[model samples]
Target: MQSYVNVRHSAQGHPSGVSVLCVSSELCNRLGACHITMCGTGMQRCTLNVTLEQAMILSRNHGLMPRCIMQTMDIMRKQGPRVELSAKNLKVMDQMTPAFPRLFKLCLPPSDGDL
Candidate 1:
């Protein structure tokens, strides 16, 4: 039923719709573990294809961006995350404003400039 639904939705003009693949165990054995490179990690991973804005949003939402740019350099390098950033995203990252690190549970007072 879900397959039928997917087909129907796909047929209805959603070209970028998510795709699903199901294969028999026999086929899986035959295919084996073919070399497949993956981007992202765990829940912080990005989609197979993503835009620059999307990438920035994902990284920020995942708390990958650092509040302190200089300090986070080591952390970002050590993690070695492969984010396919666009030119725009790169520019924004370069001029990033000071803010709390992503995913930090501790409360931070709002920036002094803001009321």
Candidate 2:
């Protein structure tokens, strides 16, 4: 079996706390997780595979706008080919990227003739 390290926030309190998990592709499928990979500084690759329900909870709990969430997910997915975002999702992602740089790292330029 493939091995991976997962990070989780302490279950005490802090409602807005963040929990991160890192898992390999094989382990991800074995655990029935939907994974999203992100590229960090220094070319480090990070994988996030929080459950869909947990993501929805984070969205609602943190009062995050839908567009912002999509953009953040887009930025994360851009690191690898494992995840696919829909066209409508791309639209929302485009709208949020420029406006919320603090929430996501959108270093990529607009695609094709989006200029």
Candidate 3:
């Protein structure tokens, strides 16, 4: 028996698909180790090709400006992260906020309390 791994892609820089091959022992011996065969039908991966105009309309429906989206994506690529607060800190703050109502209430002065 013979097995082969194939890397496939379209000439336009898109995914073509993935395929597997299995051969009989006799054919494998005849073909030797290196064998090339055309990929069978239904090998291409499913894809959706949308034009720029259609994409823009879709973006509009989603309330996104194409230019702003592009800029935001670029900024994301440059920045390590968008939010500074750590998840631990956020969780701690959430827990403490409910547990210490008096601490938060201290921000407002009591009418009869000492200055």
Candidate 4:
């Protein structure tokens, strides 16, 4: 099992992030689903039954940038499975690491309230 957090930061460094849990091919076969948590102004969680390769391909073809795909894979390889990306956990992480590089390129513009 492997996972990575794809974080985006506003110009003022506010985090608007999405966390992805990348399941390896073997693990995907065994577990049959991967948990995904998306965080920004709010959070949503879902389960998807897809292997790492399938995920990469789908993301690439469906508008995810190339750099994001590469970085996500790299993080997954290095980090293994450590953090569970629930909303509370992500908020804790946001507090701990406020300066992570803007990993997500396709970010929506922050609303006036976010500023």
Model 1: worst 10 consecutive residues (lDDT sum): 42-51
What is the per-residue lDDT of model 1 for residues 10-108, given as tens digits with 9 covering 90 to 100? 556774332231122223435664322233331122322222223333344566453333234334434434342332246745554345345432333
TM-scores, all models, native as reference:
0.19, 0.21, 0.18, 0.21
- lDDT for predicted candidate 4 compared with the true structure: 0.44
Q: Please provide, for model 3 over 5-109, each residue's C-alpha lDDT reduced to its tens digit, 9 standing for 90 to 100.
A: 233568998744432322222244356653333222211211111122223334445665555543443344345222222333467434423343453355445
Give every collision pair in model 4. none
Clashing pairs in 2: none
List ranges where model 2 is wrong by over 4 Å: 1-55, 79-115
Q: Which of the two candidates, 1 or 2, achieves a greater lDDT against the reference?
A: 2
Give each model's whole-structure lDDT. Answer: 0.34, 0.41, 0.35, 0.44
lDDT of 2 by residue, 23-52 (tens): 244356567775555454312233334332
Best by TM-score: 2
- The reply for model 4, stretches above 4 Å from the true place, is 1-62, 82-115
Candidate 1 regions with alpha-carbon error over 4 angstroms: 1-17, 21-32, 35-90, 94-115
RMSD of 3: 25.7
In each prediction, how many residue pairs overlap at the backbone (N, C-alpha, C within less than 3 A)? Answer: 0, 0, 0, 0
- lDDT (Cα) of model 1: 0.34
Which candidate has the top score in lDDT?
A: 4
Write down the worst ten-residue block by lDDT for model 4. Answer: 42-51
Writing each residue's lDDT as its tens digit, candidate 4 over 5-104 gives 3555778998643333433443444676643333452222222222245446546457655456656555554454333444345675455444433643
